[model samples]
Target: MKRTLVWLGGMATVTALLVASTGAANAISRGNMPAYCRGEVSAMYATKPMYVKTGKIVKARDGSLSIQGTVDKGSEGIKAFACRFDKKGNFIDVMAMTSDGE
Candidate 1:
């Protein structure tokens, strides 16, 4: 009876760990992209007090990812940008999105 109780306790611990790990993975997968992009975009723009408003993550046919958004640099006006990343979520580049949709 004691051995059986030990086995059950071990299984319960393993189950709890698995559940916790799954939650953490989900959080990482759905990370705060807007906040993450904000820092990088602000640095690129070289502006203080910048704001980034980003939309959902988009997956391209080439397996890359992009976050489309706008940056507001108070007096400098707002500009559209696309933050590009690899399939593994590694940042590639941030580029201005022109009015002509370039």
Candidate 2:
């Protein structure tokens, strides 16, 4: 009976450990999901034929991507603005804080 009790205790401990580990992994997976924002930003630029001065990606955390830079228009001065990307690597919204408003 003592051996049986020991075996049962060991099994319960192992089961608890497995459950805790699984939960930890799940939490990690949901921690940060902005791993694909760069690709999405590149796609947006490639699809358009406009001349963008090339912006640097700023805040890219927790699925939020922010880029602040300039856009070039021939015969006109460079326009600066900020672009934001959502979690799914899609264009959440683009804000033109300067001459070029998107």
Candidate 3:
């Protein structure tokens, strides 16, 4: 009985650690997004029904922002899009989109 309890306690500790680590990783992922980008993300959501599945925000060569993400759902059936922004985070244009890799 004592051994079983110890094993169960160890399992619980491991599970809690896993959950905490996952939360931290998620927080780190979007930690770098500029404040203005939040508005753009919200605006994109307003005009459609979808969620960003995965994405990255990077600084462009001209000191702008380049955002690429996979969408869950929208009217155009677009699977992914590359959204561009000026240095100040103003929406520039969607440079490209891909329904499939090919």
Candidate 4:
């Protein structure tokens, strides 16, 4: 009975650890691109501790992807930008989106 209890406890611990790790993995994988683009845009443009809100991901016919988002610079106002990435998820360029929707 004691050995059985010990085995059950070990299994429970393993299950808990697996659950925690899975959650972490999902969070990282799901938000990897958006988070990465946000960080890059924030660092490149934000002058005074700005806020970055990530938007949808746009795919081009050329197999490239672009992460669209807005950067809020408080007093400096807000601006829209897109972080472009290659097919393999490589950094391409960051462009400021115009009001007319470029």
Candidate 5:
């Protein structure tokens, strides 16, 4: 009985540590977004429906990244898309919604 309790306690401790580490990693990831992209994101989400849910830096074919997120636009529900930016801080390649349907 005592041995079982000790094993359970150890497992709980390990689980807690893993959860804490994952939270920290997510916090770091949340801010790793490029500065220019943040500003553009702000502007993009300034209007109705469009909102920046989360941003992640992903590896592309060249192992370099842009940014991607799941955005919600009013009753349109949630949609995922990649972000585009130029050296001049221009936002391009915004393929959020389709004119045919949601």
Candidate 6:
């Protein structure tokens, strides 16, 4: 009976340790997800034809993202664009944008 109790206690401790470790790893991954998402989007932007200057990349804790930047249009000066991404870092769409009327 004592041996059985010890075995159960050891198993419980191992399970708790595993759970804690997994949780910490998940938090770290989630913490870095926004930066990763921004880098991914920036790489995609670099593939476009126009000259680009990245502005702000916002990644929500829920996995939503918004990226804003300016694209040079040669004779047309610069135009701002805002892009949206889903939680999985998938591109959704882009729209004309400006910084609070500036």
Q: Name the candidate, 3 or 4, with the larger TM-score value.
A: 4
Candidate of highest TM-score = 4
Assess candidate 1 and give its TM-score to the true structure.
Answer: 0.59
lDDT of each candidate versus the true structure: 0.74, 0.51, 0.59, 0.75, 0.54, 0.61
Residue 7, candidate 3: Cα error in Å is 82
Over 4 Å off, model 3: 1-50, 74-78, 99-102
Which model, 2 or 3, shows the larger TM-score?
A: 3
User: Residue 98 of candidate 4: its Cα lDDT?
Assistant: 42
**Tens-digit lDDT track for model 4 on 1-73?**
9999999999999999998886722222334778877888878775532488888877899978888888887
For 58-95, candidate 3 gives per-residue lDDT tens digits of: 88688877777655546656456666666765566654
Stretches of candidate 6 exceeding 4 Å from the true structure: 1-50, 98-102
Writing each residue's lDDT as its tens digit, candidate 1 over 18-95 gives: 998867232114376566666678787776424777888888998778888887766767888888777776676888
**Model 2 ranges off by over 4 Å:** 1-50, 60-62, 100-102
Which scores greater on lDDT, model 4 or model 5? Answer: 4
lDDT of 4 at 31: 46
lDDT preference between candidates 2 and 3, better one: 3
lDDT, residue 56, candidate 2? 52
Better of 1 and 5 by lDDT: 1
Of the candidates numbered 3 and 5, which has the greater TM-score value?
3
Arranged by TM-score with the best first, the candidates are 4, 1, 6, 3, 2, 5
Q: Backbone collision count in every prediction?
A: 0, 0, 0, 0, 0, 0
lDDT of 5 by residue, 1-102 (tens): 999999999999999999888672221232445444544554655533336554655555643446766556566566565666443333445545334263
Error of 5 at 75 (Å): 1.8
- The candidate, 2 or 6, that scores higher on TM-score is 6
User: Predictions ranked by lDDT, top down?
Assistant: 4, 1, 6, 3, 5, 2
TM-scores across all candidates? 0.59, 0.40, 0.42, 0.60, 0.39, 0.44
